[model samples]
Target: MAMYAYKDAARTVKILARDAQKQDKSNRYYCPNHKCDAHMFIRNIEGVSASYFGAIHSHGHINNCPHGASNRFNPNDYDEDTFEFDNALLALTMPGMSQTKKELPGEHGSGNAKASPPRTIRQIYSMCKAHDCSDTYNGVKIGKMLLDNRSVYMYPKGVFGWRIIEAKCKRPHFYNSIKKEISLIASTAGEEYTFILKFESEKLFKEIKNVIFLNRECFTVVAGQWSSSGTFNVFCTTFLSKKQLAIIN
Candidate 1:
């Protein structure tokens, strides 16, 4: 399926809400919650890959009443932080980013930054585009928007050879607990990939074998290993904002 990036959720929510309203014209203008005026309904859930709503009830977000009044909310209204990732992060972790990061060593220091390192051909291209907010690789740039800001803020100066890794906790509260997300998002361009595997403790490899055997993807290990060293071909020349650039800015 063609995935809709998280930033696009606002647009999606409007469409869904309009559809839901069409299902019952009478219910078009009210929140479904019997107590809350049906003000809030599903605007856009995006890749809510998980079946159950995690904390909607606790947060007063669920209400299915057909006639009940509900508040009008657009999924796009909520901050991007509420979702796991934006588009840029998703695109970066694709299978190919690992080799790309490793190869970008020459382009690292070519840009304006004195801190530039040896970057690859791809890295050079992305760094220049991302730093300037140019739409060089549109999808790739959008993907970066999905990444958590903490990881991308330093921009061309901060990340190198990075990839997002899975969390040790099967039931992570949010993507934040999922470590290396910044690195993974940063890896989207010519930068290298780094995957992380979480273990119960810093035990021996044998003790962590259970975790090892459970790897669902190989990049998880490959990216993790590469992340250990700061030596990546692509280095961020400047920090860029994926969200604003993709949508508002």
Candidate 2:
């Protein structure tokens, strides 16, 4: 009774929603009932809980909406609808991050130059925290320095590696080819963090699937974007890996 499909600010556009509600730009969201004219607005159902999309009026035409009256609605369906709507908005809002290329700090040569040593996860985290990370409205600094499609070298020196902690995929894989994964990771200073990794690749995906089947705690190196989160989202993943995971440096 607290979910609806709607457009976001960039008009890109769920829950038991746990994240802090930000500056939501969309004013009107569609009701689940196809024939209902009752629209919804973001409101805090519980005094201290995260905000959800609910009917503006407490007692009115909204009471007739399928989501408003809440006889027996499917939670999965609501989640799916919201996921698709949000992804469309995201595609419109985020720049083509996955298609761009940038130079990293630790590279060695220009002409026939040796490849720079891959920065460990801790090193990357240290650099990002100092330069690229920013504090969101939720009062937490989110990591944004990692490139989406580039190779990220992670070392098993400390507590860094992929560990399946939870599944944060909010949308159906059919909506977009991308897959969302949640894993336990650590920064350079040995501080632990959980992040969401959104990616799409046949080979890498299959490799992860195989590793998951074999072991959830494989100490393999990976490369992908380290995206930040607002609230409910918490998956950061890398699709690339080094041939050898031993820490040579």
Candidate 3:
């Protein structure tokens, strides 16, 4: 999940805090999922929170789970405390929250966003696995960043609609040279075909928010950080595009 998606995720961590507070050595928090214990060391995450967020941080030593042989998280056993924790944590998950139009499916203007030129649904699933694929994702990180920040996964949902038009100008001069007719857009996605931009060279190094043309319509560039230092070039563009496979809301 995008970190921005969890701007309020810390609220859910509080729920984990309450549920974890009462347990002693004989009782430690474990994964509720019967099949996965490797991910049970959630307290490891808590320690970092304490050092950064506030005064509360329980070293795994205090919980006594010792990597295995621990009790599982059973929400049925707790009230007010766990409830807050679960809800707060859930806030960060798709299961825990509702979708807003702002997060449009990205691959193909399906309302989401990404780095590579948008893709078709059939194509997205073909490449799905671990980092690029959805079925094999395990959210481990390097430093503070999830290794797969550029990835996108969509659950089943109802009909989605949009168009995709992309154009890139490698040279800043080329950007100025493009005519308004080349930039102004149709009244809606349904009215146009693919508009792909592949500019060859660009001079600027700053992030782009949105590019405005002669027309009032807008194409937003979602901000993301790179994993390594590299000079990237190009003035970009996109129209609209859509694919439908997400069944979950």
Candidate 4:
């Protein structure tokens, strides 16, 4: 059993089970399933991944709740599909069916739709782990700077729904020649996020060139750091594992 979704008093965000404990227990967080009455405030079990919102526990839910480990009513067996956390997070962020059609989905687009502004890394991190964020601030020298300046630092953990487009020439200093940078974009679901790879002649860059850049409409993930302005600092690029990009077509 795992907690697939949660709604705090102020915000509704999909999260891992470990994060549920951070919510304010007074108002508490709730499971996403409408019929599931299980509250994550009580359901959360620290260090135990199996215990989550929607998991079967002492406090039971109605028949319609899907969190039951096994379907007693159904005699036949079915395949249990697996999904990455990012995909689940994306689903939780999306608007419901009752929302206006113009809102649609994705991080961006829809001129009339008032989408939440893109959050900085600090903001995203803060939202996901409010309790730990203060600790994160104390651990890094730049943390104080971030708080003081209201700047967001991006240490890219991964990218989704984007594929390599091409390498492009960026302006260079007066004494230097133009620099090469890779480019990618994700457009599905109306969210538009562009990636500009800071070029390096490393093995990872070569792999991206040979595998992702060469292929059309391929999805890729990346790990890297971003400047305060939210630009991907290609120099800080980190290669993602095969597993991270495997789910993408």
lDDT of 4 by residue, 83-169 (tens): 122333243333344333333322122222233321222222222222221222223322222211112122233232311111122
Q: After superposition, how far is residue 178 of candidate 1 from its true place, in Å?
A: 26
lDDT of 2 by residue, 108-193 (tens): 21221222322334222222221212321123222223311111222222112222121122222311224434343433343334
Per-residue accuracy of model 1 over 124-236 as CA lDDT, tens digit each? 22222222121212233432322222234334543333332221212222112223122222243443323233322223223333333344222211112122334443222
lDDT of 1 at 240: 19
Quote each prediction's TM-score: 0.22, 0.24, 0.18, 0.29
Tell me the TM-score of model 2. 0.24
Candidate structures ordered by lDDT, highest first: 4, 2, 1, 3
Which scores better on lDDT, 1 or 2? 2
Please count the clashing residue pairs in each candidate, in the order shown: 50, 13, 38, 2
Off by over 4 Å in 3: 1-19, 22-26, 32-35, 39-249
Pairs in clash, predicted candidate 4 = 3-53, 198-234
Instruction: Give one digit per residue, the lDDT tens place, for model 3 in 1-249.
Output: 111010121322222322233242123233322233322222323222210011123422223221122222211111212222122222322222343433423322232213231122222221121111121212322111111112211211110122111222222232333431122111222222212222222321111212332211322111111121121221123211112111110
Tell me how far candidate 4 lies from the true structure as C-alpha RMSD in angstroms.
Answer: 17.2
Q: Quick one: best TM-score, which candidate?
A: 4
- Please estimate how well model 3 matches the true structure, expressed as its whole-model Cα lDDT: 0.21
Candidate-wise lDDT, in order: 0.26, 0.33, 0.21, 0.33
TM-score-better candidate, 2 vs 4: 4
Error of 4 at 130 (Å): 15
Determine the C-alpha RMSD for candidate 1 after optimal superposition of all C-alphas.
18.4
